[model samples]
Target: MLAACGSADDSAEQPQNQDGETEQQTADQGGKADQEATFPVTETDAVGNEITLEKQPEKIVSMVPSNTEILFAVGAGKAVVAGSDFDDYPEEAQKLEKIGGQEFNVEKIVGLQPDVVFAHESALGVGEEGLQQLRDAGLTVFVVKNATDFDETYGTIQQIGKLTGYSAEAEEIVSGMQDKVDEIKEKAEAVTDKKKVFVETSPAPDIYTPGSGTFMQQFLDIIHGENVAADQQGWVMMDPEEIVNRNPDVIMVMYDYIDTAVEDVYSREGFDAVTAIKEKAVIQVDENITSRTGPRLAEGLEAVAKAVYPEIFGEAEQDEEDQAA
Candidate 1:
């Protein structure tokens, strides 16, 4: 919203006399040149297109929840005129003009006339046509790749910041996340006894868990916990018998939208012999924070680290209400 405010200050400074007026005029012209030199950004997006923004985007629309979260964290929240239906973080984002989820509303988005539209690569299969429609309507559309790790996520934030004219704020957010991750890594070095961990994404008869090629596995590596599902690849459904045979010392429940998650894990048939069950180490982690790959991911990593080994990483920093729920 304040993207166009930089030029106003120069115009606001009034001169007391003719000599001062000439000096002020020169300073104003210099400032204008500097501003002109900085803008008209042309950069390669996740897709190969060279998207250019002629000036700082005063009105922006984000097509993904993680992108919306980035926009808010980088001080560009006020510029966000609209977002996808799934964008619920930052509270205020819910109040924005909501485009359809999974499938974007091309007409509505084009009608909003956002200076730029932030789309993600992950949505291509479902939204490619909608994106092309927006482009046909002469809208600025940039596709952001879905990040699989912390480093890539940081790069995405920096990219969004640069395009939105919030580069400095984005750097600060990225730096803080890096510092927290480093601290976790450093503290994890103190672990002499690592525990075997199992993370279940969906529970009951159809149990799904992340394995070797996913971000959840990367998080497990950071916290120095052994993933029982490491032998499998990317989000596989493990048989109940197989999970029992693995006998993980810590079981992490990874869904928050459903109730009875912890209880369902505890009461599963033949799970009584499991080490995690016997020791009562079943923990519930918020999927939004842990899986979003946004600004709060490092905090999610810390929370999981703490839950796995409280003695080394301190207590899990869970909200009382969330835990109770």
Candidate 2:
């Protein structure tokens, strides 16, 4: 996903200073050009709009949970004065004033007077008008895309850092994430027999799974596990019959807002005959970590890796004991 912050309006009304010149006139007289040189940062957002920032934003608002997490991770948490309703990470984010979710509160955002607002590409579907209103109101809006893999996630982190003056911290965070992923990949290479896994993003009757060309598929490949839905593309609804026929060795249930459980998957009709159900290999994973494209994505990868290959990654405590002995 791409992100960009817009420059302030040059035509906005301004009062005259002690120098007998209006603020806009002063800006046009070279002050604005000089400011742009000091903050010569420009980025292309998800919709391919080139956004330029004239200064570091002090008051910020995040309309996407992933962006909110990235903002906090890069040490720009203090700049975020407002967040979306779903932003709950870093604990402190929950304390921020909630502007709105997919349907943004344009008036609330305008009242907050944030220097910039982080949004998601999905907002284009329904919130585009609201976003346009924000832009029209002279608010800098950065729209992030729906990242399909770790690379896009990293790009988003870097973009957010650049916009928030936390580029160095973002690079450090990205490097650490890369190192952790490399370690996991190296360890996964030792597995001679990779497990075939099925990831359920939603509950039964209306089951949904991440297919090929998605972050979940990439994650499965990184850990040397086979995604049963790899043949299908993108997030698709799967029939229970198809899932049962696949007979996955591991079933990962990814949901938390509902009352769905591993037992629920195990007890589903026909599911009982599946290898995962019979062996009790149905695992419930944190949807936020596994799904949200942000700094905690490494944690999601590790969680999936451990879940699929417990024999390799789950022996940490036992290995330490053996070493001590």
Candidate 3:
């Protein structure tokens, strides 16, 4: 597993001003010339637009929950002066000023005078006019790609690390996550009997499973489980009768639903073909972790591993929780 090492501290490399506040590097050159010295942001946005900032922004506003988590994980949380409405993870993040939902409030964000704004693909589309207004007012806007798989997610982290001037920290974090994933894969190789799982994404007890090409599928693969609804793309709304026919070995419900004592399988009348329901192997997972591809994604992976093979990964999951606590 990737060991979390505290070998190099990046606190020193973070620039500080005379007043003890972090300062953004000036855009020395104009236009494309300035892009060279700026934070090394690579990769195109969802709209296929290349985004490059002039420097590490001192004041940042995060307009996506996932992006907010990434910013905090990269040791740039202090730089985030504002956040979107749904950014409630990581207790410290809740303390930031709210800038509306993924459909961000451009006026509120503009009022904050952030040096830069980090937005998700959806956010830009939903609030393009507002975002453009901010850009016209001289604020740098960077829209990162929404990765749909593991490799792309890892690249997103590295890309963010490059943008924030924390390349080493980003590399170490991703490497550590990679190691944990490797360990899970290695251990799961010994299990000849892999569980087939159906993951439900809604609170209404609907049969929804992530498609074969999605991140959730990659997450399940790391845990040595096969998604029964792998034929579809993204989150597909499947019928309960289809789920009964599939009869997966395990069912994953939203963690919130666990407390509510709800079951998508059990709710379907006269449908008990699913082995998971018979064996009570249904597990609940945090929706935010599974839903978003961000810095703490390793936690979500660990969650899946624990839910799938509690025997092998129980101790590791406990250790991760202890460390987080």
Best by TM-score: 1
Displacement of residue 105 (Cα, Å) in model 1 is 1.2
RMSD in Å for all candidates: 10.5, 11.4, 9.4
Regions of candidate 3 where Cα sits further than 4 Å from its true position: 1-52, 255-258, 261-268, 315-325
Taking the tens digit of each residue's C-alpha lDDT, what string does model 3 give over 1-325? 0111111000011232233432222111111212333454555655676767556667889877777776666556767899866677566678899877634566777788887777666444446677667778777777767777667778877777677665555565677667767887887777678888888776444556677877888888777788998888776988877777888887877547345644644655755667888877777776677667776676677777777777777843475467457
- When 1 and 2 are scored with TM-score, the better candidate is 1
**In candidate 3, how many Å is residue 149 off?**
1.8
Runs in model 2 deviating more than 4 A are 1-38, 315-325
Q: Estimate each model's TM-score.
A: 0.86, 0.84, 0.80
List the candidates ranked by lDDT, beginning with the highest.
Answer: 1, 2, 3
Residue pairs in steric clash, candidate 2?
none
Cα miss at 291, model 1 (Å)?
Answer: 0.9
Overall local distance difference test of candidate 3: 0.66
Candidate 1 local lDDT, 1-325, one digit each (tens): 1010001000001111223332123222322222333577887888899999998887898887888878777666777888877777767678889776765677777889999999887777666777877888899999887788999999998888788776665676788788889999999999889899999988778999999988988898998999999999988999999999999999999877679899989999999999999998998877777887678788778878977887897766444244445
Instruction: State residue 142's C-alpha deviation in candidate 3, in Å.
Output: 0.4
Residue 316 of candidate 1: its Cα lDDT?
61
**C-alpha lDDT score of every prediction, in listed order:** 0.77, 0.76, 0.66
Residue range 104-202, candidate 2, lDDT tens digits? 678888988998888887556667777888889899888887787888889998898788776765676788788879999998998899899999988
Against the true structure, candidate 1 reaches a TM-score of 0.86
Q: Which ten residues in a row have the lowest lDDT in candidate 1?
A: 2-11
